[model samples]
Target: MKKEYKIGLSIIGLLLLVFTFTDMNISNAVYNPESKFGLIFEAIGEFPSAIIATFCTVSLMLTREKDKSIKYNLGTVGYIVLLIFFSLMASMIPVKYLHGPKALIPILMAIYITVSYVIAKKCATTHKEELRRAAIVGILTFIFVIIAFNSIKFLWGRERYRHMIEVGSFAGHSMWFIPQGFASGNEFMSFPSGHSANAAIMAWITLIPTFVTSLKDKKSWFIRFAILWTLLVPVSRIVVGAHFASDVTMGVTITLVIFTLLKNKYINNLEEKDAIHMFI
Candidate 1:
């Protein structure tokens, strides 16, 4: 893994550990009709981007096309194997069921694997471009996630999930523009779902293009499968009640904007200037 990505993951893991402890401390903070913010935070963990980003940053370490392709293939295959294992574990962990799994996630997993295999087969050269595409993508994803987590905490301050207590205002103000929680005396921010943002970021930005970029054609069998896998990540989050559709929209919007900017401004221009890694 690149130094930056390692740092990012380490930080996130540490932060999550902290939150788990804090959550334990505040376990009694739950309320009946949840403030939208509370619900958003709870579900934000299911975002596709969040999962993909975690993988992509590490994969970015590959400098040679061969290495990159190998890592991509390996990571993807590993995920499917793990998913299958978890599928069997469903009896022990309800989350393993994948809210709307009904053959959808499984089918997409198959597609992801098949298309990814085809793309790996298509690479004619093993050139290592000097451009920092991998690192750039990684950094952008890392920054987006950091922002998402912070925003969730700040916005969902009224979260009383564990403690079962809901008290506060959206902006900690009474003004209408201040936007109170979903209801009276409510406190929480629910408009944008962090989970959706997390999942959409990877699906829309990295996973989708990562698959299609190497494909011969979008309409080809490979592309079709790649697209399905990409879309499935975000949809899975919603199916699990981790985020509202609107939250996904916002996440998609952000992911698209950032992706387009990065793809055009940097990734497309990734010629070997022989510069150092870009994610510092």
Candidate 2:
């Protein structure tokens, strides 16, 4: 691991330790249901995931082609389909909160696709193998983070701070360590903040150094951005009473761990076979 990563992990460990004890207190102090800033963040929290999914999809599709003619093999097509599905699902998470015209969703998606295609094409043409590997690592990281956090959220079934506030009591509140398994609805899926987990996926920006040689020396900048975005989203979640400190911390931890492992296995380790290629 890099020295930066070591330092980053240490910070995360300290946060998890500190937040575990102060989770409820932090939420109680910061909870503001009507805060516009919190509402805005909550609405667009999934945008990072959508962008990552689109970028990976475009990268994989362009890099896998033999030529510019765009002939896609069955495996490539299947992967593209799956990535598009993930992208759409993520992008739609904020639609209900947008309170805008219905056309806004498609417009934003079009923009994502256009920008992703241009960037992916450039990388594909110049750094074919590197881009393909990065795309695979990114896609796997996104999928695994989603699955891990959501599964834990469902099984843990802790109530959201906001929901408790709405009901006028914390009597039903459960600690982060407790499993209240399979309760009523979305309110119960609060042990790990899905918004925080999804926001942490922005850390995928750090992987650009692995494929884009020009930005290799500037990796620390990207790392700082990732760290900033990750921390900011969790703060937003807490401010809006959507999650406690521990829930946000655990959510960020899930993505960071999964991303680090997959990045090491597929991007850093040259001898390792691509997981998708092994079967496809």
The candidate that achieves the highest lDDT relative to the unseen native structure: 2
C-alpha TM-score for every candidate: 0.41, 0.87
Which parts of model 1 are misplaced by more than 4 Å?
1-51, 64-125, 130-135, 156-189, 204-214, 218-243, 269-280
What C-alpha lDDT, on a 0 to 100 scale, does residue 67 get in candidate 2? 46
Q: Each candidate: how many clashes?
A: 25, 0
Model 1 residue 160 CA deviation in Å: 11
182-239: candidate 2 lDDT, tens digit per residue: 7569988887988899899988888897679899999999999888888888899999
lDDT of 1 by residue, 86-173 (tens): 3332222223433554556555545444443343334212422322354456447546655764464355433222222223322232
Error of 2 at 146 (Å): 1.0
Q: Estimate every model's Cα lDDT from 0 to 1.
A: 0.42, 0.83
